[model samples]
Target chain A: MNRFGFFILFIIIIFSSKKLYSKNIKVCSTCEFKSLEMAIESSCNYDSIIVEKGIYKEFNIIISKPLTIFGKGTPTIDGNYRGEIFEITSENVTIEGFNIINVGESFKNDNAAIRIKNSKNVTIKNNFFENIFFGIYLEKSSFCKIYNNSVTGKATEELYSGNGIHLWHCKNILIENNIIKNVRDGIYLEFSNQCNVINNISQNNLRYGLHFMFSNDDTYRKNNFQNNGSGVAVMFSRNIEMLDNVFQENWGSASYGLLIKEINDSKITNNVFLKNTLGVNMEGSNRISFKGNDFIKNGWAIRVRGASYSNSIVKNNFINNTFDISYNGNINKNLLHKNYWSKYNGYDINKDGIGDLPHRPVSLFSYVVNKSPGAILLIRSLFALILDFSERAYPIFTPTYLIDNEPSINKSE
Target chain B: MIKILSYCFYDITRGYWISIYLSFYLFLGFGLLFLNNDISSAIITLMNIVIYLVPFISLIFGLTYYYSSREFTELLLVQPLKRKTIVLGQFLGVSICLSLSLVFGLSIPFFLVGAYNIENIFDLFVLIVLGCFLTFIFTSISYIISIMNDNKIRGLGYSILIWLFLSVIYDGFLMSFLIYFEQYPLEKISLAFVLLNPIDLARTLMILNLDISALLGYTGALYKIYFGTFNGIIVSSIILFIWLLAPVILMLRIFKKKDF
Candidate 1:
C-alpha cells in the first residue's frame, strides 16, 4: 500500500512538471505575454508561441530556439521599413500563417523579411511578404521548404532590389507554388545544389525571373516565367533539369526565354517558349539536350553561339519563329533530328511521317543578320527570300550540316 | 474629270482582264485560307504574297492596259478633254479597278472563314489599304513611264525594270550597304532607305503593325519607336501618299507637253 502511494505521487509529479514546460504561450495586446519578443524570450524550448490577430509593429525579432511560431489568424508583423522581421537562427523552426511586410531596403546589406542563417529543416509556409527588399533568404542552410508563399517587391531599380527567394550555399531545398514578382531576380540560387523549384509563377521582375549561378544538380520544373526583363538565366551550371516550364512574352532586344552560358550537360525538355525575343540563347554550353520543346513566335529560336558543342536538339516543334536557328560559326558539331519545322516544304513520298529531304533550319538571311544586324531590315523582302532559296540550293554562308535529318511532317502534340 | 473617270472606270470594269485578275485573287485567298485554316496565320501568309505579287501585277497590268489602249488614248486626246483630266482619270480608273478586285477577292474568303470576329480584322484592313496604295502608286508610275516613252516595248522594259528595282534590286543594294558598312551605325540610313522604296515602306508599315516587329531586334525597335505610334503611322501614310502623288503629277505634266 505504501509502494502504491509512492507510485501515484510520482505519476502526478511527472504530469504536472511536463505541463509546466512546453506549454502554449499566447501573445496579444491584452494577454499576459503582450509582445512577441517577450513571449519568445520567456518561452522554453519546444514551446508554441501563438500570436493572435493584431498588427505587431516590431522588427529584429530573432528566434534562436527550436520553437513553433504559430499565428492564430494570420497576425501581421509590420516591420515599418526598419529592418529584418524574423531571423531564424535555430534548427527545426516552422513559421506559418503570417503577413510579413515593409522589410527595410538597404544597398549594402540584404534585409529580408525572414532571414534563415545556418539552419536545418526550416519550413517557411503560407506566408505573405510584401514591399520587401529580400524575402525568405536562406544562407548556408539545408533541408528548407518554402511553400505556398507570395513574395512581392515594389522595386524600381536593380541596385536597390534583392531577390524574392535568395539561396546561398543551400542544399536540398524545396520551393513550390510561390508567386514572386517585381524583384531583381525572382529566385536567385547561388551555389545551391539539389534544390527543387516547382510550380512557381515568377513574372514582371526588374531582371531575370530566375537566376542561377555556379549551381549544380538542380531541377526547376513546371514554373511560369513571363514578361520579365528576361526569363531564366542559368550560368556556369551543370546537371540541371529544366522541364515543363512555360516562358512567354519576355520580349526585348537583349531578352531571352532561357539564357545559358558556360553550362554543360543540362537537359531542357517539354518546355514552351512563346513570343520571346530570343528563345534559348546558348553560349559555350556543351552536351545539352533539348527535346519536345515548342518554340513559337520568338525572334531567334535557339541561337547557338560560341563553342556550343555536342548538343542533341531533337523532337522540338519550331512554329513560325522569325528564325528557327541562328548559328554564329561555320562548324556544326550538334545533332538536330526528327523536329517539325513549319517552314519545311519537303515531301513524304514513302508514306511515312518523315520528309524525304532534310529541313535546313538556318537560312542565309539569318546568317547575314548575324553578321550584320542591320540586314534584318530586309527580312521577308524578295531579295532575301531569293537569297535564302538560292543558298539552299548551294550551302555557302550558313552552317552546312545544321539540318534536321528526319523532319516530321506533322506537329507533335 | 468625273465624266472621264466614270467612262474609264466603266470601260475597265467591263474588260475580261479585270475579271481574270479578281478570280486569280479569289483562288489564292481561298486556297491560302483552306491550307492554313487559322485566320491570323493566313493573314501572315497573305502578307508575303501581297507585298511582292501585288506590285508586280499592278505594274504589269497597268503597262499592258495602257499599251493596248494607246489608240483609245489618242481618240480621247482628239476630244475636248484636257491632258490633266485624261491622265488623272485613266490613272484613277485602273488603280480603282485593281484595288476593288484585290479587296473583294480577299475579303470574301476571309469573311466566309469567320475572320470578322478575329482581332486580326484590323490587320486585314491595313492589308487592303496597303494593297490599294500599291496599286495607285504602281499605276501612276506606269502611266508616267508610258507618257515619257512613245515606244511600247521601251515603256514595258522601263516599267518592269522600275518594279524590279523597287522590289528586289533596291534591297540588294541596301543589303550590300549593310554588309559593307556593318561597323557603322546603319539605323538612320536604313530607315531612310526603307522610306525611299515604296515596296519596303509598305512592308515595314505592315510588319510594324504586327507583333513580329520584336524579331527585328534593334533596328525594329528603332522603327517601332519611329513608326509604331500614332504620329509615326500618320507620317508613314503621308509618305506613301506622296509616293502616289509625285508620279501622278509628273504623268499629268508630261502628258500636258507631249508631242503626240
Candidate 2:
C-alpha cells in the first residue's frame, strides 16, 4: 500500500514539472511598452506581444526573449531603407501577421525581411513582405515553421537579386502556404536538411520558381510553380518527396517544368506538368519514382539524357505531346509502368485500369530529333508520317524496353 | 572631286588604326562563344569570323564608305565635275576600298582554318560574302538617309532603327506572323520573308549548320529546302546577290534624282 502511494506521487511530480515548463504573457502599447524590443526585453517569460496597427519604422529588432510576436491588422514594419528588420537569435519565437516592406538591398551583406539566424523553434506565419531581397532567411536555424506569407520583389536586373524565402544550412523547417512572386527564386534551399514545403504558389521569377541544391530529406507538396523563367530546378540532392505540385507554362529553349539534374532517390508523385517546353527533364537523376503525375500537353513530356538509371515512371498520364518521351541514348535503364496515355491504342479487356498491350512511348521521330534537329520540320509532312508509321510498325530504331505494358485508357474521365 | 574621293578611300584602306575595330570584333565574338556552353569549337570559330567579324567589318567599312562619300559630296558640288560622274566615282572608290578591307579581314583567318579541311569552311566564306553584301545594302540605305536628313543624329537614328529592324524586331515580327498563321503551310511563308531580310538569310545559313536546325520547325524546313543541299548553297548565294545589288541600285537611282 505504501509503495503504490509512492508511485502516484512520482506521476504527479512529472506532470507538474511539464506544466511549469512554459509561461505566456501579453504586451500591449498601454502595458509599459513603446517599442517592440523594449517590451520583449522587459517581458518575464514566453510573452505574446500584441503589436497595434501602426507603421513601426524599426531597424534590427533582435529578439533575445522567447516570445510570440503577433501584429494586429497587418502592422507595417518599415526598415526605412536602413537594414534588416528582425534579427532573431532566440528559440521558440513566433512572429505573425505583420507586413514587412522596403528591406535594404546590398551586395556585401545578406539582408532580409526577417533574419532568423541560429534560432530554433521559430514560427513566422501570415506575414506580407514587399521589396524584400531575402524574405524569412533561415541561416543555421532549425525546427522553424514559416507559412502563409506573401513575399514579392521588383528586381529588374539579375545582379541585385535574392530569394523570397532563403533557407541555408538549416534543418527540420516547415515552409507552407506562401505566395511568392517576382523574386529570383521563390524558395531557395541550400545545404539544408529535412524541410517541408507545402501549398506555396511561386510564379514569374527570373531564375527558378523553387530551387534547391545539396538539400536532402525534404518534402514539397501542393506547390504551384508557373510562368517562371526556368520552372523548378532540383540539383545535387537525394531522398526528396515532391507530391501534388503543378509545374506549368515555363517555356523557353532551355526551360522545363521541372529540371531534376544530378539528383537521386527522389519521388515525384501526383504532380501536374502542363504546357512547358519540356516537362520533367531528367539528367543524371537515379532511383527516382515519378508516379501518378500528369504530363499534359507539353512540347516533350519527358526527356532523359546521359546515364540516368533505375528511375520509374508509374501510373502517370502522358497526354497530347509532340513527343511523349525523348531519350538521347539507346542504353535503357529507366522503366515506364502502368501509366495512362491518351495516344495508347491498346485494348484493356480485363476491365482493369491496366491495358493488355504495351505502349511504346519513344518514337522514331524522337530518335531522328536526337540525331538531327532539322528533322522536326518534317513533323507535319506526309513523308515523315510514313517514316514514323514504318518505324512504329517494325519497332527497330527506338529503345525496345521503353514500353508501358499496363496503360490506363480512361484517365480524365 | 574624284581625286579627293580616292584619297578618302586610301585613308580608310591604308589606315593601321582599323586593327582596333578588328580586335573589338574578335573580343565580342569570343565573349559570345564563351557565354554559350554547348557551342562546339568548329561552330565557334565559324561564327567568330563569319557572324561577328564579317558583319562588323562590313558595317564599319560601309559606314565609312558612305560617310566619306557624304564628305566628298560637299566638295564635289562646288567643283567643275558633273554631278553624275562625281557621284559615280565616289561610289566606285568607296565600294572598292570597303570590299577589299572586308575580304581581307574575313579571308585570312578563313584560309588558315579551311587549310585543315574543315567542313564548315565553305559556309564560312559564303557567310562572309553575304556580310559584305549586307554592308553594301546598308551603305545604300545610309546614302538615302544622308541625302534626305541633314541632322547627323537623325541619320544615326535611322541607321540604328534599320539595324534593329534587321537584327531583333524582324524576328519578333516573323514569329508573330508564324504564330498567327500556324495552321497554314509555314514553309512558304518563311521562304517569302527570308527573301526580305539578309540577317534572316544569314541566320538560316548558320542554323542549318547546327544539328538542331530541325528544332526551328517550319522555318527550318524552308531553310533546308533552300539552303540544306549542295544546290541550295548556290541558290542562297544568288538570292544574296539579288538582295545586295537591288538595294544599292535603288539607292543610286534615288540619289541621282534627289536634291541634296
Q: Which candidate is the best by DockQ?
A: 1
TM-scores for all predictions: 0.91, 0.60
Instruction: Give the per-residue lDDT digits (tens) of candidate 2, residues B7-54.
Output: 666766567645555554445444544554323344534443454334
Q: Candidate 2 at residue A229, lDDT?
A: 79
Question: How high is the lDDT of residue B119 in model 2?
Answer: 52
Interface RMSD of each: 1.5, 12.9
lDDT of 1 by residue, A1-413 (tens): 69999999999999888778779889999999888999999988988889999999999999999889888899999999999999999999899889999999877778999999999999999989989999989999999999999999997988878999999999999999999989989999999999999999999998999999999999999999999989999999999999999999999767899999999999999999998999999999999999999999888889988888899999999998889999888544799999999999889999699999998999899999988888988877889999999988887877767789899998886
In model 2, pairs of residues that clash are A373-B214, A374-B213, A374-B214
Clashes, model 1: 0
Model 1, B102: alpha-carbon shift in Å?
3.8
Please report, in order, the local distance difference test score of every candidate based on alpha carbons: 0.90, 0.75
For model 1, the superposed segments whose C-alpha errors exceed 4 Å read: A1-21, A330-332, A349-354, A408-413, B19-40, B103-121, B229-238
> Largest TM-score belongs to which candidate?
1
DockQ of each: 0.66, 0.05
